[model samples]
Target: MSLKQQLKDAVAKQKKARDITREDIVKNAAAIQRSRQEQKDLSNRPH
Candidate 1:
C-alpha cells in the first residue's frame, strides 16, 4: 500500500528471481560438464 512497502516487495522479488537464475546456471553448467565427460568416454572406447 505504501511506497516504501512497494519498493521493498520489488526488491525481494528481484532477489528471488536472481537466486533462481543462479540455480539454473549452476544446473546447466553441471549438465554440460557431465555431457563433456560422457563424450570423452565415448571417444576413448573402441569401435
Candidate 2:
C-alpha cells in the first residue's frame, strides 16, 4: 500500500513477538527511507 503502511509492516515483521521501541521504529524508517533514496539515485544514473 502506502509508504506509511509499508513502514508499519516492516516494523511488525521485525517485531516477531518482541517488543518494539520508538527508537527501533525510527531506525527502521530511516533505513527504509535511505534505501529508497539510493534506489532512486541508481535508477537516475546514465548507465
Q: Give Cα-based local distance difference scores for all models.
A: 1.00, 0.89
lDDT of 1 by residue, 1-47 (tens): 99999999999999999999999999999999999999999999999
Q: Tell me the spans in candidate 2 whose CA falls farther than 4 Å from its real position.
A: 1-20
> Which parts of model 1 are misplaced by more than 4 Å?
none
Residue-pair clashes per candidate, as listed?
A: 0, 0
Give the alpha carbon lDDT tens digit for every residue of 9-31 in model 2: 99888886456576788899999
Residue pairs clashing in model 1 are none
Q: What is the lDDT of residue 38 in candidate 1?
A: 100
